[model samples]
Target chain A: MSADRLIEAYLNELATAAEALPAERLTELIADMTTHIAEARADGATSEDDVRAVLQRLGDPRDIVEAATDGLVQVDVPPRFRLRDFGAVALLLIGPFALVIGWLAGVWLLWTSDRWTRGEKLLATLGWPIGYGVAVVCDWTSIPLGLTLAIAAAITVAPLIPLLKNGQPGRSATRTRLAGATPATSSNR
Target chain B: MVAEKVFTQLRRGTLEYCVLALLQGEERYGFDLVKELGEIDGMVTTEGTIYPLLARLRREGLVETSWRESESGPPRRYYRSTASGGQALADFTADWERFRTSVDAILRRGNEGRRK
Candidate 1:
């Protein structure tokens, strides 16, 4: 069989086998199988009859899924779920503190800009320090679990600081699919 | 952006039950479940994806598997829903209906608001 024909048979067997298989995953599996079959054919499995027989020996498609997902646990959290939940909880819990800090930060920058405008470069440049002081004082006062909350906020915001370091969002899903197919020891050993 | 997450969670919550439901009456192996899901208009998913889920259900003791030799090929694993799995599926169906109805209501409400 041609590589394409071999892949078609392979996928047909697969589709007929699993009633809940996702199409994306099936397409991925078919692409992999097709590539492998092409390579095998190139390696001198000359006849369609021979190739068909070889494919048959590779076990049923349904068995492949059963082996792959058996006992596997995956957490498919959407990108903005916990982040949104995080927003909601933070709003109820520490939203007031955040707003104050942001406002004070902007005010502090303004004062620093004023000092620069007045040519008081030596000592008046401490506007940032002043802002930090104000924010810390606010943190110490009303935010109940203020320090712990601030620490968590810093950590959470720190990830966003390096968002660009991660792969771009558009193709990330496809990349995830590919990475997940790190062939399990259950098969092709 | 918020909507994307809601849709994803909705799909995730129901997909597990859908898989179990398909296998309720008969003991089918992996690919059969994938094909069945794909045949549905908006329910298409891949077999490769379903395998991991099957493994999950088996591990959770919601489903069980055994080998059944196929005449066309080698022996295949056959999966059947367990009693607990069946019960869970029933609960899931209830939950799904509630979620669907509520979501539909919300969508309709939003549409009416837009029209107004």
Candidate 2:
């Protein structure tokens, strides 16, 4: 093959291999490779053999893509079920039955934490309190207070769904590493 | 195979610091920097990987980049180590000194046992 074709083929392979990379990152990688080739040419690599050598120095496209992907992996502090997180969830779940003071404490814990998002805090905070309030005011249930509270508790903790979806108690370290690295993959646009 | 894997790990661990060390007193464009790093034995097996590494270092606030017109061809993205990068390099250098000493001592002892 001609020198230019060889360079083109290598770059095409690189782009194909790195297809999983964010668009911006892929563009930058291609640009960098192209510039390196041009610079190598200017430095005296004119023959097809020299051009092939330059490409060889760039390594296999698949390996380059793999290295690039590895670099994109974000390292974040794993979300452990800390004592505070436990206390927040507990107080939010069962605290409402404790004359509302336990629930209020849970609300305090929930808001102060960085674990759950604002929407979660809003849902967890408002759901049980309002539902429990209505339960108290209606006084319509002959189902007995204990049973009603259990049902109410189940219904109110619906906000925990999002957390349950992601916050696996025994999540593998590799999976959690991928979890916190979302920003790199997400902010492509 | 195991030796190659260990070397790969070692290269990955120290490659960023090596880049940082190069950018200590001067800035270099991507091509210039990658070529320089490629000259080192086993420091950079894949030259293209340096671009991704540089991009990551930039994202991590360890290096800063800016574009400047090149006399030969297209505008080039030049990189220099940030203050944070310099500090990290200093910390790594100290740790590496101790680490190298310990590893060398262990290897030497192992070699002696084999010869005996």
Name the candidate that leads on DockQ: 2
Per-residue lDDT of model 1, residues A1-189, tens digit only: 274577687778866564344565555455544533544455466687767754664457766655444333344423332233223323323333567565344334433332123332222223334435656666767756667456555543443322223312222222221114333232101
Please count the clashing residue pairs in each candidate, in the order shown. Answer: 28, 0
For model 2, give the TM-score of chain B.
0.95
* Top-scoring candidate (TM-score): 2
lDDT of each: 0.54, 0.79
State residue A13's C-alpha deviation in candidate 1, in Å: 20
| Predicted complex 1: DockQ | 0.05
Error of 1 at A152 (Å): 49
Off by over 4 Å in 2: A71-189
Native contacts kept, each candidate: 0.09, 0.53
Task: Pick out the ten consecutive residues of candidate 1 chain A with the lowest summed lDDT.
Answer: A170-179
Report the lDDT of model 2 for residue A118: 71
